[model samples]
Target: ASRCAKVRSSDVAVLELERPGSNARHRISEEIARAISEDKAEAIVLGCAGMADLAHSLSEEHGVPVLDGVVCAVTLAESLFKVGLKTSKIGGYAAPRGKRFAGMFAPLSPAG
Candidate 1:
């Protein structure tokens, strides 16, 4: 509860599910219904990747937008690729300088 409280704000309410799993569809729906009626949440975002399959049905059931992180991530990646936007390779994600690859990975070594 403390963690949820720490992340909660006036605009965002973080509600935890009692039973978090793909099989807990009924529980998840009930929790989302509570958030809608009580907290007045306009959209629902599933917290677990395992819940991705339920987003569409839940949205239809609750008459609100439901988002899955996996789908959102893939969609975002597609949009970024279409726009020619890519992750910068100069900072934390930069390949190691002067690194040598041997064995089956020899061809993957970055050019100096």
Candidate 2:
């Protein structure tokens, strides 16, 4: 939440839930309800990739858009692909210029 506050102006709320527990749907629904009523949240974004499956049903129940990060990422990637957008090879996504690989990774070292 603190990190988010530094980057974004909107309020950030963290709701922790058990990763493999059976009651996630219930707890998430309760949190969504609370966020809407208390925080005036217009939409909810699922924090965990594992929660992707619950977004649709939760949105239906809460009457708001519930977004899954994984889905959003894939959709953005697909849209970029469709529009022939490619990552710039001269910048951050560029091939390493002088990176070295040692031991079992020697074959991965860039060639001269």
Candidate 3:
């Protein structure tokens, strides 16, 4: 809230997710609607990748912009790439420090 307030002033209301998995779309939508009603928020910001596909539909159903982080990221990256804007190789851009894995996560090791 403080970080965003530095650039733009707004009310930040944190909504919690009670359920999990892709099957929680309707429940999530209900929660979003509830939040909007309670907070009088102008838009819905989806916090999960699984909610990407529901963005447009939810936006239309709720009469407001429903933004999904995954979709926004992909769209922004594609737009940037099209305009020849590449990511800067500084600070957080460094290559991942690989590590070993065990048990059921062994297949996800860097060696693989």
Candidate 4:
């Protein structure tokens, strides 16, 4: 995809040997190893949402933390909620202070 977008940089690496349309664990793991070694990375972050299920196994295989963005988001939300670190109606979530509006969106003024 990046290639098709004309992205040319040493910072990017692509695994061209993997079978097309296949995101199997082994194939992903192979690519992860390549990226880690080629980029001298400390960890692997699964790039696709479909790879979320393989995060644990891949992490174990590579001896590094494999991160899935979806899982990270959910985990962060849960942790914050558990710690009562969320928006509150009495504070940040409170309605905006009085303000005027004009034109088509005039009715959306805080005064309204």
Candidate 5:
């Protein structure tokens, strides 16, 4: 559970709330909504792996995308074996190149 991991001296802040059932769509949605509202998570993650199908609706209410465990597992797998990460380094990351630009966006920076 996220809360358990968070308290494990890992410096990870987490909150976990369990739902009554996964097969029951409405129940799961309610549980997730409650958690999102109460937990105030920086980014909400779906507790149930089976809720991948309702990501859009959840995001709409919470204003953030919900992540599923299955996708995470596969991503961890690929990163561990270096099968795709090293082969295609650009796929996972990129830096914003430096360039001069004149625009109102300059005031967006905190220092500006």
Candidate 6:
């Protein structure tokens, strides 16, 4: 979503796959290839952090520029924090470590 937000409206098209968990490399690469072949996209920005890890391979496979939001976000965040910044403390936003869950996929956690 941030990728979509970062891009200029007149410049690029954003396409998302249904299940990013299943085929990280192939799905993004195929979509990018299609975009390159059809829409004449000059670059493909990876939409997921997982896809970010695959950014290099995807760029090579598609022969186009590939970007990872993680890298860019981290750089921006670090710069902000370094310049004396702090996050809001009044909102619903908080650390995930102390959160409780009541959902279809309860207590979700990352897989190593």
The number of the candidate with the highest lDDT is: 2
> By how many angstroms RMSD does model 6 differ from the true structure?
13.2
**What order do you get sorting by lDDT, best first?**
2, 1, 3, 4, 6, 5
Q: Quote model 2's TM-score.
A: 0.62
Quantify how close model 2 is to the true structure by its C-alpha RMSD in Å. 7.1
For candidate 4, the 10 contiguous residues with the lowest summed lDDT are 4-13
Candidate 3 residue lDDT tens string, 1-112: 6322122212222232334443355666676677677766777777666556778988998898889998889999999989999777777997677888999999888864
- For 8-96, candidate 4 gives per-residue lDDT tens digits of 22222244323465445566677777766776656776665666777898898888888898889899999998998967777768977
Of 1 and 6, the candidate ahead on lDDT is 1
TM-scores, all candidates, are: 0.59, 0.62, 0.54, 0.57, 0.44, 0.48
Predicted candidate 5, C-alpha RMSD: 16.6
Better of 2 and 5 by lDDT: 2
If both were scored by lDDT, which would come out higher, candidate 4 or candidate 5? Answer: 4
TM-score of 4: 0.57
Which pairs of residues clash in candidate 1, taking residues 3 or more apart in a chain or in different chains? none
Name the lDDT value of residue 18 in candidate 2: 36
The CA lDDT of each predicted structure is 0.73, 0.74, 0.68, 0.67, 0.54, 0.63
- Model 2 misplacement above 4 A: 1-21, 90-112
Q: Which residue pairs collide in model 2, if any?
A: none
**lDDT by residue (tens digit), candidate 6, 37-88:** 7667787666566456678877877788788988989999999999998886
Q: Residue-wise lDDT of candidate 2 within 36-71, one digit each (tens)?
A: 887777778777776778899999999999899999
- Which runs of model 1 end up more than 4 angstroms from their true locations? 1-23, 88-112
For all candidates, the clash counts are 0, 0, 0, 0, 0, 0
Q: List the residue pairs that clash in candidate 6.
A: none
Off by over 4 Å in 3: 2-23, 88-112
